[model samples]
Target: MLEEFVSLGKWWLPNNPEVVVPGKLSFSPVSGAKLELIGSFYSSQFEEIGQVEGIELPSDFVSIEENFNLTSRVRIDFIKPEEIIILGLLDNNEEITLYRCSGRMKSFEFVKNRPNLLFNIACIFRKIHFQDEQNIKLKSISVQYSHLEQWIGKSGIQAVILEEENKIWISYQPPSNIHLTKIGSLDLNITFSPINVNPFDFYLGATYYKANIEQKTYLTIQNPGNQPLDECINLLISFRDLLSFAMTKPTSVISVTGKTDVIQTKPIEQANGSITLKEELRETQVIIMFGLWNSEKNSETKLSPNEMLFLFSDVENSLGEVFETWIKKRETYESVFDLLMTTMYTPSLYLHYGLINIIQALEAYHTSKYEGIYQDKKVYEKGLYKKFLEVLKDFPSESVDNENGISDEFRNALKGKLKSQTRFTLETRLKEILSEIFCLLPPNFIGSLEARGLFARKASETRNALTHHDKEKRKKAGKGQELVQLFHTLTVILQICLLRELNIPDDSIKILVERNRVYQKEWRPSSN
Candidate 1:
């Protein structure tokens, strides 16, 4: 009979339901079973002996409930039986009835031809007391929250919580005083219910809900509203409570919405991914919205909706403007900018790549300047001969011919042809090429050659170590601090190169270099 009911119930109930019905039995087979329960009932027995002889009859009473007894049962249907079926009866409507009953199977018997199995059930029942619900609603609230130690800019964070009957709604507004007016991309970290309970359980809307304990999730919206800049954006989230231990398990839902007066509002898709912000020539404004559902586990628990908004704007600096100018003058400037932005964002990992790219950019510029010079056969031959003569200067006159297997004429021709190649060492080449690019030599160099020389040497060594796996040299690099310093110095060098390419005045370039050098000491690699 129980098996028939269990099969019928399985077909009648849905696989997963919002609410579970009462008197549902979920059964699983086991190998052996043991059940035990103890109960005590108390009563008093009194006997009066009537005696005419005695003036007063003494009443005698005995306590009948003082004895304690325990009942335990274990049953083995067969020797090494195939299986033992365990049954559990659920009182799903305990919230309405204010009562709970639990039972376990103690013994089982299987008959050869009988369709139903016989079993013994022991159950315990208890009544529950109802708790009074406390409701709290706040019209406006201010909450400051950040992924890092403090908020980035000087914007104030504000939030609000609204509760009507069993529904909860929260909204957080970020600071509006953004430094920029446009945004390219953004990332936000939202924490829901910083405490233990899952706030999404109370979500009360049409959206799907996935249960997460102490839920902390991140939602990123890109190209928001599909406009250049989103003027208004709204996000809705819903949560349903599966466990109904208190207050009938109210569903909580919230929506985060904000508007900006910026132009070119675009429609964006909602996504659950991360976006990396890059340095841009123009300022880009971004807004991050955070929604939180605050609730405690108690009859008089205070449920509050809290939210915070963060506004950030990426503004251009002098160095960035110089890069922008380079983009117009040089065809390869975009590649250089990509490397620079990558290094700026993730310095510890790609700073070396940035350094190498700067060198390449300078080389490209140099090659382009002398491209026409090399195209002229007369000038090319003259330059080649000049380089051959310079190479000959390193050897004694008598031994020059015997230095290699080639004759004097062939050797000279070969040296001349290869004169335009990279002849100087990396460090020497950096200093020499930088000197030419910046038009600074003796007394008016943007930075001291001695200081630049040191930087060049360290940069060369670090690059070599990173490329060739020089353990000793890498150990001397000292935990990337020197690498970061070298990266900053190289950045300044590139900035000077860009400024010179734009026909900027030498004095202005020097002033910019000096100003940026101060920031070098405090600049550290960031992964933001």
Candidate 2:
């Protein structure tokens, strides 16, 4: 298996061969320019399947380089039994190659020196459909990183291909929190244009970031019963190890700060950085200073933790000590909850804002239908807030006693106690209000809102566990489970809500429902 696999590196081979051996195959840079030649020769067929690697001219699709570097041999056992599609970034243009190598039929050689070269050895493998002559078509290949070329063989890509496809479409402007993950299930057809294609595959491969992990998903063309036109397809959806790049190496520690209030810190280039103990880092805090705000007089205002809290507050405030006092007073969890409640009832708040807008628009349509006589602008809002208060009044903050068999009064008292100290912080209030408004939403709105509620609850739980929960509880919670659930739930809710709000009036909402159903059908307790 290993011998056949090694045959892939060699693009050229000696005349007809005999015995074949299995061994490891690897790629190393050759010269100073952005050129690399992949080399390999098979022992059995005595042929070279040489690959000329270098920048292809901007105008030309295929270019043969003058010189080649890097030499290796083919491993017979490792010869891919299926069709393979690989991508090479030549200059700025991307070149995709489909290789259909069967058995130990070929090989090639690479030159040893040169500096400017970059190659990602990962390839997408799909079953081959060979034509009579030389034309070949690959269907639904498993796409993966180059490192998986070892132990996993052709099957390593399966982890991504067979995994579930989760997508959501949001219709808000960017720079807005029109989140893709918070609404949880992503199978919905979202209205987003493509960014640069991840170099994972030349075609049928795309990716999006979720929880900071780069996941590559492929889209392919297939007939879905009578839908016309080519549809996007999936090959694999897997996470790549950040350390795969030879140019990237880890170091001890590095720190940087921001200059302006508007500057958000995102990685442009990652370099030598190491993980450290929380205590060590705590001693020397890395205060990333994104300018908070500025006064009219051009005086720069640095935001303290309390000032930052006020900045995110729902109510606008002045910049003086009065505003600071108000924020400090309002920073309690109860204050947040109250803001959440207000936001949930109002149409302009985070989660509730979208629902309110939709419901208000729908109510407007309903009123215009009956020409204002039947219009009850307050019905939706009324029902929503009533339910909000009801839930707030009834929701038990503490667990019900199973062994003690407590009385109803005891339970009620316990619930009230939980509520007493629990002031509505802005974040909590927003989540709760949205959850309630969504719940009380007309039948059309409930499904998506419920999903969003589930997502928010999960996120809240996870955040709590990370920030405040004891070690024992964290252990019981397991790793990343809550966060994943939160993301999934957010995806579903966002898609449902966005689809409904777009008011496309065709089958858009129906399409989202159908997609959700398709995903729901596959849900299992074990997977959760």
Candidate 3:
């Protein structure tokens, strides 16, 4: 056995071959090599332990692995106390096997030798295995649904289904207090069947549907499956009944405040009401309770402050035309549309998470369109490599050779050592890639090159802060309103980028971007 040697540095191994000893337990005079070990490696007897008497054995265990204790005593050359020394065993073949020691350094002693100082080190190795077994633990899981209230219809009602043990529970919750007059006329039911087992169906009639006079009522359906509940189960709901229940609304009175008088009005709720078609319409007070009222020309109607109504037949038609065109190029725009819709429909509370998702979606779309261009060896070497080098030139040096009075050759060697191992930070890398990609956009589309660069930097910083939970940076990134503006800005820019990659007409893209409310914000468009 050869005497064990030690290597020391910030990292486990040094990159400088000149400093490393070849086929021997020796090294060059390095300042960070605080200590060296000279000893023979030895192990104590191996011990086997059986299970406790009358205890059940684990199915996976046949026999417990033997445990042994390893110990070594070596002469430690204590060059510096603060620097850490990692000891390893060097074999006759010059192979170094480092010890995975959990024990701390102990029992330090000084040996006098003037400039050639050393210390006595006695390292102890203990083998202890502590395994924790718990009966139960809580885990967070995500739930996915096919439809949300806002996307389907603005009914303000949501349905969520959760699984526990062998039962599937479906609950329909209302946002506010409202009467369900059609509760008696409606049929509420749930059909649950495990695919692995026979069909298990459950139904609830109008009598089972519960409701209160003033407060909203929650309807729940619980169906126990015949088989054990796995991680996920296929669930289907009868949408006809659910949609009918969602579309019906309770009648309410409206009060209007006038300059001199207060007017209270009641709406006529007819079970079966019919309206005659008219070609022309004048400016008049016409209140629509429910159902579509079609018109060829525009007519203005006064509405209450809190009344929510949408008048966008023309806008809808225009958007439908654009969507039809996009569908023609579905492969180009489908992913972008999916992510954009997800961001748009994200709940207000999780807008930050939504922003991050949109950013990822942008990156994905960019890679999908231009990955070949970036990954081509010839193109990369000729174009992007030079650009990458230019960006790398701006990175600050992280040299570690100034403290000792070393020779110029060593200094230059260390400088080259630092340069060879240098790499760009994540933020710098993202900014460079984004800047290069955005350069392909139409000229002046994203303002100046400086603007593009700033966009990448800001976007990367905000994303990193949000991801790494840098509270100070995140707080300074923006308030809720500012984040909303930033979110809209990012979404619009990504949409535009996707369209441009699809080779859509610039005029059509401009029209789409300008007409959308998300792009109408005051925030300037940037690469982020």
lDDT string, candidate 1, 437-523, tens digits: 554322333355566666566667766777678888886442457565665556556656655665666765564454433343422
lDDT of all predictions, in order shown? 0.35, 0.27, 0.35
Candidate 2: deviation at residue 289, Å? 44
- Report the poorest 10 consecutive residues by lDDT, candidate 3: 251-260
Model 2 C-alpha lDDT per residue in residues 110-195, reported as the tens digit of each score? 25421111222322111211121122222211222222222111111112233365644333221211111111111211011123
> What TM-score would every model get versus the actual structure?
0.30, 0.21, 0.29
lDDT of 1 at 63: 25
Off by over 4 Å in 1: 1-332, 342-358, 361-378, 386-419, 422-429, 432-447, 453-485, 495-528
Cα lDDT, model 2, residue 347:
28
| Model 1 worst lDDT window (10 residues) | 238-247
Model 3 C-alpha lDDT per residue in residues 1-528, reported as the tens digit of each score: 011234332112222223332212222111111223221111211222332344454555432112321111122222232212223323432222222222222223324211221322222111111011120111211111122122122233343545555544443433432221211122112111112312332333224354322212122112222221121111111221122112111111111000111123434546578544434422221110111111111111222212211111212323223333444444554665556544443334387788787776666665555442324556555675656556445534445334534554654565454443333443445455546445444445446667656656666667777888998787546456656765665655665565554455567555544444423443444335
> Model 2, stretches more than 4 Å misplaced?
1-459, 466-489, 497-507, 514-528
Model 1's number of clashes is: 21
Global Cα lDDT for candidate 2: 0.27
